[model samples]
Target: MHRATFMELCDLLSPALKRKDTKMRGALTVEKQVAIALWKLAMPDSYRSVGNQFGVCKSTVGAAVLQVANAIIDQLLSRVVTFGNVQTIVDGFTALAFPNCDGMIHGTHIPILAPEHRGDQYVNHKGYFSMVLQALVDLKGHFTDISVGWPGKMHDTHIFRNSGLFEQLQEGTYFPDQKITVGDVEIPTVILRDPAYPLMPWLMKPYACTLDSSKEQFSYRLSKCRMVVECAFGRLKARWRNLLS
Candidate 1:
């Protein structure tokens, strides 16, 4: 982003925090650090290269990278940020374009370096090890309600149970007074998933499975509507390769 945009974000966030006194540093500019972070994100540069050109420590460069990235995320990205009826929460979200479709929930495997991690956290679903990052992204693929980061070895179902999304819903909090749930199985609330799994409430499914063309027409339509979330997810992954990697 341009310096003006960064400055704008800083301006927006500045109102939320108490002011601090600091010289920033010597001849090296804070803007330069910000620029470095941007460049790293735009084009995944090594921390050493970023630090070398930006005239800062590698650690500082990494910190700057995360700070600037998160700031950009916080500033530029938002929920129901895409096109659609944001009031309706769908099961899977591809992007903001179809908010009426709700959102999509999927597990993302992120490679990490936590040597001491063990048990389910340490288990690897695939041959390579990674961390599971599940997110409830809106139509625009931006996480709206929940995002859980855990080790890759964990079961998707177990992760879901532990994610606190269910627990959060059980508490009847409010993103407002209403919440919509969509999944492959049944659940125990006003909102629920499809496919009708056992021991769950609000199970939304096709009701009857048929290959004769007219079976589960509503389900087919819902799936068609939900494809927007899939597209949104594709765009999101493409935009943030580092996130999925």
Candidate 2:
């Protein structure tokens, strides 16, 4: 991460990560805790190896990493990753040739070590233990919303339906009183997804086995727009090799 970005994150997380010194010994400063966590995330190393570099015990490293991670999530998630007003989202997708689209939704598998119990629940069709990270990304390749911790064995559609985003859409409060015009027809803002997802008023999927020219054209345009989510996931996994490993 860039120095400025890291500092900004630290500032945001300070409230949550700040520690009170005890009489026995001062706790590790927030800076050191964040550094330890960042190092662990940036490298694929065991806790013991990371602890050796930081001159701390393996358990301390683990605790610090988890603490810093939760702090980041609590402080930065809503601020950095959000879907703004409906008009802005519509304009973003319109620029990509996908009229009436609010965002693109997809899911990727994040591999993980098998757990002690119910390990089979994490084993996906790809024959590996993993977790699913379902996300909605805007045209700029930024995540607008994300759902994590679902077992890989679950279908992408199942994960999406169970997500908070799905609840928001069902409640009809995510983009209230907003409509988009596509040629002659007016429709509500919708998210674009693949065949794995279900078609709904707020979510759209390409027509399967399209033979009509218009349908094919629509599918082509939707695919081009939906590819943004895949690219976002690709860039994320590439930048964080720990996710891939």
Candidate 3:
């Protein structure tokens, strides 16, 4: 991150990360705490390695990582990850030839160390320990909504059904209850999904079998537009190299 951006983050996290020095030792500054956490997240390094570089013990590094992470989620997550200006998002997707589309929904597996308890639950279809990160990617390739840390053994359809986004969409509370008529079909604002997901009024998926030219064209357009989410995932893992493993 740029220096200005990092400083701004420190300011935002100060309320939660600020600490007082005790008699035993001087407290770590909020900047140092955030740095430690970011380092751990950006690098595939061990707690001992991070502690050595930061001039602290492994326990301190671990504590700082957890504290800073919790602070970011509690203080910054809602502000950054949000469904902003729904109409604008719809307009953006409309320009891309998918009318009344809100966003693209997809799930990616994030590799993780197997937990001691119920480790098998984290083993995915690929037979590896992982967690699921299901995200809603907007037209501009930003994450509007994310459901992280679901067990990898679970399917994308299951994760989406259980998500808060699913509830809102199902109740007609997520996007405006507006419809656009395409021929005889009146389509509501919907997010594009893969064939693994079940079809819904607010969610669309490619046809299992393209029996005609029209169905093939529809599936082609949906697949082409849905590439945004795949690119977003690539960028995420690229920037956060720790997730590559």
Instruction: Tell me, by lDDT, which candidate is best.
Output: 3
Error of 2 at 23 (Å): 1.6
TM-score of 3: 0.90
lDDT of 3 by residue, 1-245 (tens): 88998999999999999999999989999999999998888787899999999999999999999999999999999998988888898898888788999899999998888798999999999999999999999988889999999999998888998999999988899888889999899888899999999988788888997459888888888998899999999998886674444
Provide the lowest-lDDT 10-residue window in model 3. 236-245
Go through the candidates in order and give the C-alpha RMSD of each one to the true structure. Answer: 6.7, 2.4, 2.2
The lDDT per prediction is 0.54, 0.88, 0.91
Per-model TM-score, in order, reads 0.60, 0.89, 0.90
Candidate 3, residue 174: lDDT: 85
Per-residue C-alpha lDDT of model 1 across residues 98-182, encoded as one tens digit per residue:
2223444556665555456464465586655676766555544455554546777776667766766657644655233543344
**lDDT tens digits by residue: candidate 2, 1-245:** 77897787787889998899999988888888888998887777899999999999999999999999899788878887888766777887888778777889999998888888999999999999999999989887889899999999999988988999999999988777678677898888889999888899889889998469999988888999988899999998887774435
Candidate 2 accuracy as lDDT? 0.88
In angstroms, how far off is 243's CA in candidate 2? 10
Poorest 10 consecutive residues by lDDT, candidate 2: 236-245
Best-to-worst TM-score order: 3, 2, 1
Q: After superposing candidate 2, which stretches have Cα over 4 Å from the reference?
A: 1-5, 181-186, 242-245
